[model samples]
Target: MKTDPERFILENTSVLSPPHVPEIRLHLASEVHDLWLKTEEDLEEIGLPPPFWAFAWAGGQGLARYILDHPETVEGKRVLDFASGSGLVAIAAAKAGAVEVLAADIDPWARTAVRLNAALNDADLAFTDDDLIGRSVDFDVVLAGDVFYDSDFARALVEWFVNLAESGCLVLVGDPGRSYRPTAHLDPLATYEVPVTRALEDSEVKKTTVWKFRQ
Candidate 1:
């Protein structure tokens, strides 16, 4: 990568906790408007992705809250946190006693952010950049937060999530009514009024739902 992600993140962000889940702290951009635009232009120049890791999104906050509140959901299980921006959900799983936790995202910048955030919370987690959408994997629980925004991507994930659920792996997701989220296969586990950055979302508070995927 052309840009030094760790140095940039450290220099630009603040140590803070998400509103709904305060137990874990992350490096976040306090003033997202300027930082968000700056990162967009900088990353565009360097051919890197936008920094989704710079904020604790609503879906992630809700999912992390659920995992911390219901520790038994992930206790003693091998877990996967897919699209793990900043590793928030993965860290919560680790705190909840998951035997092993793997956080996966395609962004290289997210890799650095996850590592730094994990250290802040003293949580042990492994990370991968591999695209595991259609691939079968061994895991007791799979966690996804704030996905399903795009039509094509959500289409692919639905099939993969269904396969995991049908194969007896517990699949869970947190969503804030994204346009493409499939509600038919989801069993609502919990609901949360999660605080979010107004710059990134239309509302300051999002009505988020944590759902268990079922066959």
Candidate 2:
């Protein structure tokens, strides 16, 4: 790794609130400190992943809004935020009074980002860098935001989320019409026209949906 995760994140991002969920603030990349301009080759050269943690995605913003608006969804429950980019949803769960909140992401940079964000929000959260796919879920609720972008990951995640739902855990996901989201396995809960950066998405507003995993 060419740059330290903590140092890079601290230097490259500014704290800001996402458009859809302004109640929570996150460290996000802006035009002044853009990570999006960096190509995959540049990232590979630096031993970094795609830097997904550097922005507030539409799906995550919608999910965080839902959780904040409906505190009962997480209050006193054990919750896991899977693929927790920027720790937005996980911090929301923690603020909503979840007894325990775990933010899991495979990237070391993501782990560093989540930790710092949690600290910034004064929220208690646990973090794991291990890939938790196919593992038994210990939490009462599982939340995933914008995790269906990758085909391979979406396939594995769908099966695991279904199994978790069947096992009596309440599983929820937020997605913005990703190609791999398993519609057959989801029950629609709410939809939001989430505002996002055009630099990252095709439009400035994305129609994102929150769904419950059907058992």
Candidate 3:
């Protein structure tokens, strides 16, 4: 990393609440356009991946809202927030009375962002960078948000999620109607009109859905 992730995030973002889930606040990039452009420029310069962690994506916002509204789903359970960008879902799970919560993402910057955001909310969350796909999961609930954007990755995720669901782990996914979502394997749970930056998404508001993975 060229610069300190914590310092860079603090400098580039502001502590703001996602519109869909105002109860939870996160450190997100304030100027979406500028940050996005800079992220593209920094792709090779600083080896930074896409700045997905720098925003409160619609899928995560909807999922966080769902978890907060339906606390019983995660209460007293060990939860895993897979591909947890910004740790929004993980924080919500912790705040909703989950016995333990783990936020896992492949990007190290995302882990840093999650740590900073968790501190801002005073939520205790464990973080991991390992790709746990096709591996045994010990958690009682598994949550993923906006992970089906890519076909190959989505295919892999669906397989792993199916295994977890079959093993009695409650799996939930929040998506804004991405093309790669495995709708056949999901049961609709909830939906929300999530506010988003036009610079990042096609529209200012996205119709996001929370789906429970079915075995």
Arrange candidates by lDDT, descending: 1, 3, 2
lDDT of 1 by residue, 1-215 (tens): 33688888898899999999989999999887677666766576644444778889888999999999999999999999999998999999999999999999997688999999999999999999999999998999999999999999999999999999999999999999999999999999999999998888999999999999987
Task: Quote the lDDT for 213 in model 2.
Answer: 96
Model 3 residue 29 lDDT?
84
lDDT of candidate 2 at residue 166, scale 0 to 100? 95
lDDT of 3 by residue, 73-181 (tens): 9999999999998999999999999999999999758888999999999999999999899999899999999999999999999999999999999999999999999
Q: lDDT winner between 1 and 2, please give it.
A: 1
Worst 10 residues of 1 by lDDT: 41-50
Clashing pairs in 3: none
**Candidate 3: residue 146 Cα off by (Å):** 0.5
How far out, in Å, is residue 95 in model 2?
Answer: 0.5
* Residue-level lDDT tens digits of model 2 in 21-132: 8877788888622474452333555444457888888889889988998899999999999999899999999999999999999875789899889888999999998889
**Top-lDDT structure, candidate number:** 1
Q: What is the lDDT of residue 128 in candidate 3?
A: 97
RMSDs, each prediction? 1.6, 2.1, 1.6
TM-scores of all predicted structures: 0.95, 0.93, 0.95
Off by more than 4 A, model 3: 37-49
